[model samples]
Target: MNIVILGAGEVGYHIASRLATEGNDVCVVDQDSERLQVIADAMDVRTVCGKASYPAVLKQAGAAHADLLIAVTTNDEVNMLACQVAHSLFKVPTKLARVREQDYVRHPELFGRDDLPIDKMISPEGEAAKVVMGRLNVSSAQDAREFFNGAIELVEVTVRPKGKLAGLALKELPDVMGELAVYVVAHEHNNRWRVPKGDTVLLAGDSIYVTVEKKHLDRLMKTIDLAYQTPEGRNVMMIGGGRIGYLVAKELEQAGAKVKIIEFNAERAEWLSEHLNNVVVIYGDALDRKLLEEENIDRMDDFLALTNDDENNILGSLIAKRYGVGHVVTLVNKAIYMQLMRQIGLDVTVSPRLSTVATILSHIRKGRIHGMASLADGQLEVLEAEALATSSILDIPLKDLKLPGDTVVGAIMRGNEIIIPNGSVAVKTGDHVLMVTTGESVPEVEKLFAVHLEFF
Candidate 1:
């Protein structure tokens, strides 16, 4: 696919790198020649040094024949303008714009916004807020990825000794839980991803990736001893109330979470207090250890640092971890720092921009997958989709059907039960199926399912 990216920042960089690495014809546009040169040297793609909002600059970046154009600049105005130029001027098939401003996000039609020139809009701050909400609701989970149209959620939890699953072998999991794909994607013991086989055994402290219906999330947590006694405690402490922090705090407070927003600016803090309710606004620098300690940060069940500065969020989250905070989620927009943080053992890293862009790309690549998630650094794509009626899988028992070696059907919901079936299992009409496959086999995997299911 011919793709054009209009930003040189962290979000754009990560998207461009991933897309280019996946063998797409990628071109990047930015005003900074130094950043362009760095990206050019790193990835095999064209780099144009000019303002992306300009038509001539976009033309120079080859937007006319591009299959998709993504504008992810930090500036919301530039992103919108770039999308408009791509869609209205160049007629690019798909246009995506990054909108971080709270006003634009809440009401895109306001302020003379274009009348739907862009195909899609992404808000990294809003995306980060959703992640924070998921973590807060699912107390034991360090991270959560929802799929199957929100019917099921893939949750990441660390195994502890108190649970029935702590020392159990992989083969025994199904007997204990009764039909669930509790795959071990990554293990903290050796700090590497494990390609699961039946014989693999789980140990305490191992990071386990399991899939369960939203209704079953509690039951799954009970197996791991991570379910919260009072799920109603939704109070959240947000440090560095910047774009991400403001969005997250606002969403949480609106959803009945008592949000306490700490901002360095007195004016911003005052503004938030006046505009937001059920919120305890504080004016103080999050980097000041004394101020943070005074706020009783240790008492907060969940702590999130959403400052633009990656170092501040990382350092602050680390400190909060030491204070026995149950969940610590930080937003690191920069890809380089995120890699470093993960290597140093940061449990959960949220990049709204990257996650949003990848989501858009998944839809573009395979029309069948409306929602997709990549586990293990994009090596695997877990997709929720339907099968074609005339496809090879129709009227065939699932267990007897031959599937691609790289792909596995994680779950199929015929009427309920969220059936985790074996090879002899057969899929019926009107059934929703979830499959996990590497990127290369996505197309083939899609062909097996009958086409009666809605493609999104």
Candidate 2:
């Protein structure tokens, strides 16, 4: 695919590099000559130094022959205008834009007025909110993903010996979870991907990614001794009035959870109070222990440190943990900081860059794959895939079908319900299956489920 990206910022650069890595022709445009040179030198994409809203820049970047044109400039107006010009002049088939403002996203039609040309819009703030909610709903999961229009979910859970599943073997699992097929994609013990043998045993403190069929989700959870049911409304404290805080509070409020927001800027606090009637906004520095205590942070169910300052957010979350908050989540932008923070105390970390990368991969691999996520430091991937009509293993009983041990078929969502299958369970056409596999097992899984005959 020939693609043109407008913007050379973190999001744009990451998207362009990823698409280029997938063998697509990518061209990036930016107004800064220095940034353009950096992108040109590092990535395989072509770079043009000019304003994206200008027709000459679009022509210079080969937007007319582009399959997709992505407008991701920092300015929302620039992105919107670039999309409109590309659509009208270049006739690009797929036009996607990145929007940041809360009001525009809250009511897209207000700005989607007939003039703006765009097929879809991606909001990093909105995506961050979804990621936070996914963790909140599944208390046992370090990460959560929704797929196939919310039909199924993939959750990453740490195996602890205190639970009932502490001493279970691969062969014994089928006896306990007769209806569910369990695959252990990656294990931290040996630090490498290995196909599971029947004698393989699960140990405590091992992180494993699992897939649950939406219909049989309850049974699968019961067998694994995990609390699969959604958590009841819990008190959540947010430390920011920025876009991420607003969206996260909105999601929590909609889920019936009590939400409180703290902002250092009085003007932003007032705006949040006016815009979000459900959230209690307090104008105060979140870094102050006194202010956090005054807001009853000690009694909150969860604390999210989302302030722009990385150090402040990290310190605030640690303070909340010391005060006995059940869960402490912090947003860290730097990849290296994530490892350091996770090691110190924070249970989970959210990255906008990681979310953007996952989204772009999904868009580029949309044919056979529903989506892909890199987990446990790129060692494992929770992949959602669609089976083609003539796929090799179509309509075969899962037990009789041979599959790599490292890959597990988590769940099958046929329509509205989730199915946790067993040996007798047969995979039919049009059923979306979630698989947990390591990098090594991906090829075997794909070959087993190949939709078309191999020509080479």
Candidate 3:
């Protein structure tokens, strides 16, 4: 596919790199020549240096023959205008813009084809908030993503030192946990990731990704030693008044969570106080130890450092953890700090760039894939694809299917029922199949679920 990406920032760079790796003809546009140069030097992609919204820039980026146009400039207006220019002047088939402002996203009617000509709108804040909320909901999960319209869930949890399932082998889990209905899709041990086999044993500090039915989530959590029950009112402290922080506070407050926000900017703090009801907004710096102590950070159920600055967020989250906060969730934009944050005892690290890239890949993947998530910093991928009648693996018991070495069938969603697959389970046509696989195995897994051309 010929693709034009309007932005050379983190999200744009990662998307361009992945698409180019997959053999797509990718061109990136940005006003900053330095950013374009960085992309050009790092990847096999064409880069355009000019204002993204300009018609001449779009044409230079090959928008006229582009199969897809993705506008993700830092400015909301620029992204919107770039999409409009792509659609109006070049007739790009798929126009996706990264819109950040809540005002634009709140109004759905404003984004129609006749109105803005954007086929899809991506919100980094909204996507990050969704990930944060998912983690909070699971409580014990480092990451939680739903698939097949919430019928199935992919949850990542670290094995505790004395946990019940810490040293248990894969084949002994069901017997040990008393008919537990979950699939251990992937395991990360000492920074090495693999699709576990029956003999694989989970060790302490290993992060295990599992697929389970939503209704049986509590059972899985209990088995893994994660907190499954919610207290009367969970106390959440947010250290930012930006878009992601506000959205999280609002969602948590509506769900009966006692929310408090600390913003360094007094104006933004005042705005948050006025806009959000039942949430305490303080005009203070998160890095100030005195302010954190005054706010009783140690007593909070969760501490989230979501400021735009990666250094501040990392420092704030470290201080919170030092003060014995129950859970510390930090937002890190740079991918380099992800492992470092985890090593320093952070509970969860949410990346807007990774979230945005995952959202983009969901739409970009081939076959009948309805959802996609990048896990373990893009090394692993969890995908949900529909099983077609002509699929090669259809109606065959999973044990007999010759799947790729790095792939695991996590769960199957059939209508209202969610099935945690076993050896006896055979995939049927129209079933939404969730698979956990390495990045290299995605295409092979997709082919397994794809309909054959002979059927048509």
Taking all chains together, each candidate's TM-score versus the true structure is 0.87, 0.83, 0.95
Q: For candidate 1, write residues 1-456 as lDDT tens digits.
A: 789999887778777877786677999999999999989999999999999899999999998898888888778898888887887778887777878777777886642335867766777767677766676667568677777667777777777676677778777877777654454433344555543556677887677667777777777776655664323556567887776677677667766766677888888888888878778889988877788788888788777887777888898888888877777788777656755665565777776765676666565555445566666455566777655566576667755677776566677767655765566677766667777766666657766753321211
Leading candidate by TM-score: 3
Q: Spell out the clash pairs found in candidate 2.
A: 179-421, 211-410, 213-411, 214-418, 215-417, 215-418, 215-419, 216-418
Predicted structure 3, TM vs. truth: 0.95
Point out where model 1 deviates above 4 Å. Answer: 110-116, 161-163, 178-189, 229-231, 340-345, 363-366, 376-379, 392-406, 415-417, 428-430, 439-456
TM-score pick, better of 2 and 3: 3
Q: Model 3, range 1-456, lDDT digits (tens) per residue?
A: 799999999999999988887678999999899999999999999999999999999999999998899998999999999888888999887888899999999997998778998878999999999988887887668888888888777888888898887898999988756876888898888777788999999888888888888878888887666776442398889899899999988898889889889999999999998999999999988888899899999899888888999999999988888888877788999988987766788858899999999998787665588778999888888888898888887988999989987988899988888889999999998988888887777777878987221100
How well does candidate 3 score on lDDT at residue 61? 93
Model 2 lDDT at residue 305:
87
lDDT of 2 at 141: 65
Per-prediction RMSD in angstroms?
3.5, 4.4, 2.4
In model 1, the worst 10-residue window by lDDT is 447-456
Candidate 2, TM-score vs. the true structure? 0.83
Best by lDDT: 3
